[model samples]
Target: MLAEPARKFQSLAMAEPRSQQRLPKRLSRLLVVGFAVLIGLMSVLVLNSVLNLRAQEARVAGTVELRNRKIELATDLLMATYSRHNSLVYQTIVGDPFEQDDHFQQFIKWGYEVGKARNALRAMRLDGFETARLADQDALLARIVELHDRISDLARQGRAEQARQLIAVDLRPDNLKFIDSVDQLEHYERDRIQAELDAARSASRRAIFVAVGLGSAIVLLACAIAYLTYRQMGRYADTIDEQMRALEQHSAQLKHEATHDPLTGLANRSLFYHRLTEALTRAGQDQLKATVLYVDLDDFKPVNDRYGHAVGDSLLQVVAGRLLGSVRTTDTVARLGGDEFAVILLGVGEASRISRFEEAIRANLVRPFEIDGAELVPSCSCGHAVYPDDGVGMDTLLHAADERMYAAKRARKGGAAG
Candidate 1:
């Protein structure tokens, strides 16, 4: 009986941590899902608000356009009225039958234009003030039209003096009143459009404020949830401490493996490009100079073929260390691939400085290396291109340097043959 009880207690104790571990994972998953959903909701809300603001802006623009059109039509009508009056006055003074007939035709044309403008204005939606103004303007225009007709008839009948007197007394005053009424209507429309635009802008601003406030609130809620989740995680920290440390170490190793060559411990192609891009950006912003050196190890394949990949790898590692030691800490040394390496020299502006640096690297690399109890000498062909001089972009610089490297290699082979 005592053994059975002890076994049961041990089994329960073994199951406890597993159950506890599973609970935190489920809770964390829930929190993460909830946060993602909230962020998505916030994005939707912001996008909707932006779309709504855009629509409102479009509506305001249309309203402004309509108001301007109405004002333009009203001005056109006023100008046409003045032109009609001038034609009538001219007809009365000329006394030629043909001139009178032309004036009468011109007067009729202007009258038609005024009627069209008035009809267009009437078709538009209008507020109370605009409607009253339109009514008054229409009445004045009708009286002016009647006076113009009477003047034209008198001129046609050869009563030129009577027509001139009617134009001076009755037609001019009523035409002036009509022009004033049109002016008032345009001013009223302008004021109303401005007011509406102002109101819309205020409303848009308020909506933006509301959206910002809501986003902030959501962020705060997310932070609170994160804090609670962190606290819950803390409860199991002791249980998972070793596992967390192991995971962190694994992550660091993975990062290193991703960015560095496994054999030589130099930066790989991906990390090389990343650092090169960063250096280019910095140089552009600061107006500084930099250079890229493409280095190819001469006669490296014979050693690899003779002594196997192990010696070859060790030689590459020694070469990498030498390259690292040759440059400033700010510079980058990367292995692009087998027997191929690249170096970025920062703040190197002059050709002489780059030449000297390249010579140093070559001298260091040519030194005999004692690997696996065998001595070996290695030589490298180097080609360099300056920033903003050879090329500003990565691809251009790389191409220039690569071309120079091939030329150097060809020259070296030709010299050896000679």
Candidate 2:
């Protein structure tokens, strides 16, 4: 007959499960938190990479602009230099027939302008241009300079007529040839600039396309991760909520078990200490007096020694009930240990109130007990300690009360006539 009940009890025990089997709420939260953290980290990386790419693209674009400007300046300089050369040669050759007053001045001005243009070309051209092309251009420029010098010398000798004749023979052909060569060099430079522009444009287009593709991929990846993480976080949140509910219930049950004495269903030592601290805190805050009544059973050990541990336990339960009945509902009574109990009065009016509470506790503790229908008697020695006056802390108050209880016990022993 007992076998069925035992099996049912076993089933109940199994159904209830141990505390270890429950999943931790923190673990679920950690998974959600970790996923969010990783997603945030990845998002940051993607954004930083995109920004760096844009910065690089901007740098490339700036370089392209600078290269294009160089091409423009070089082209303009070549054209200006060529024009100056044409004017110089034409004036020296043809101006003798016309004999214009501005002929020498025009020649000198053109020479200066051409020189400036050549200097600009030298400054603007790329270093990597073919050495042979550069050398040919330099040779042509030198020839132009020499031809101008020859024309200048003829004019300076006051033989304008002879200068004109020499200009027709020497100045015109050399000037035209130099112009043609410079034209060729300009065309070559144009072609090179065009190629560079084309290459830069193509690279810019490719870079922009690559950046767009990569940025899109990163955004899509981030969105996908966010979506997945959101879904996962939802599940994790539910799991955590369930675990939290379970934990709260478990915690409430544990609180109940921890605070109450198992034998007498009264407050245990932990609860008493907590209540004492709270009472003391309130007393300090409100500037009121709080009392702690320390009670230790006097003859209870004799009962345990004469009868047994079981009988002593029964007597203690009886004593706890009487003690609880004697104190106000607001007061806290706790079992410290074997035959030891403490009471915390929330708001004590005065020192006399503590004396009255001690009197009530002693009266109840010394009352007779009926255990298993057998008459028994129990007596307890009491001690009173007040907070913020006699002691400032829980430990100090308890210690003071315990000392008084021991002192009372010694006095009673001395009066026993032993």
Candidate 3:
């Protein structure tokens, strides 16, 4: 009957194998290959994601440990500097001749030692708290140097009264600032580390959840695919399962490479764009808007031109990592080849989110990049384009955003902003 053929056509349409009339061996191979590819692709993605998350957690842990050690070292140096200053002041007041020369030399030695320590601490500028501390320490060092020079002159002229007057006013204020700066720096470091540790822990939990959820879903999909293929194979008397499995595996590898950057294994341009599109689409549906920022590194080409690509590559990796740390988990960051990067701000319905994002990026890039013990000074040119208003399509939005970025870059070149 006509109804029977229609039902048969529906069954064929839903069938996993090409046709239900094929041989069992052929059908089974087809089923296996198709399912295998689907399963494999999902499995690889889940695995790679888990691995990247673990690596990031390890990096954060290492950074926390490094900051703690540097803070302890800085504290020790600061205390020693404070002690030397106090000793010189006392020597001048008490007229202690026998110990004066030796103490003066020791004081100068401590100053040099402190300077070295400060230089070492400068490399810890990846974190915002540390950068602030670095600025404070710079100011503190200037004051300390002035104090040292003045004390030496006072000692030579035997001007105890003048020395005391200097210490009481100018020297005392800087000493207070130094002590306060140290304490503030330590507190800031501890708080920042704790917050980062907490974030890492939360990210770990979320990553596990995602891996488990996706893994389960993939397994279910594979099972569904296999079952459907097996049913068709029974009708056709052909092999199916093996082919599906092979297909699944190949798909998984391709997905891994697509989502991850080949060099750094961080998210690639495609993945970033995909996520941004998804966010923008969602925002559009909700009648809201978000922001897309194009970040281009300033003066990066000169380094590549001078230091060779090996060092230049290292610099890029370092900057990428720092930029990642600067943004929120919801933000999508991607390197768009060369020294250009982009970040997408999700759910940014208001202007404040854009402001905060800009501030964080500026703060992170404000400090120089220390590469191979040499400071690599660089800045960023950032331009933002809002969703919905900028453009409704991804390609259109990106083009607008890029134009804005080049505008910012030109502005930087013209010395309008740093």
lDDT of each candidate versus the true structure? 0.77, 0.64, 0.69
**Residue 180 displacement in candidate 3 (angstroms):** 2.2
Encode model 1's per-residue lDDT on 243-334: one tens digit a residue: 33553465467557756888888988767866987888999999999899999999999999988889999999999999998888888999
Top TM-score model:
1
Off by over 4 Å in 1: 1-23, 26-30, 157-161, 220-418
TM-score of each: 0.45, 0.41, 0.42
Model 1, 226: alpha-carbon shift in Å?
Answer: 18
Q: How close is candidate 2 to the true structure, as a TM-score?
A: 0.41
Clashing pairs for predicted structure model 2, backbone only = none
User: RMSD in angstroms, candidate 2?
Assistant: 49.8
lDDT of 3 by residue, 72-138 (tens): 6566556565556756665464455666776677677777777776777775555676677678878
Candidate 2 wrong stretches, greater than 4 Å:
1-249
- Taking the tens digit of each residue's C-alpha lDDT, what string does model 2 give over 1-418? 9899999999889876654355566677887786677668666644554455445445544544554354444444444554454344344333344443355566567567656755665665355553454566677668767866766666555565565556566655665565555556545644654454455445444544443444345445555754543443344334434543553465456446656889988887656765876888888999888888888888777777877888889988888888888888888889876788888887774867777777887787777767766678777788778877787855457667877877787787788867
The TM-score measured for candidate 1 stands at: 0.45
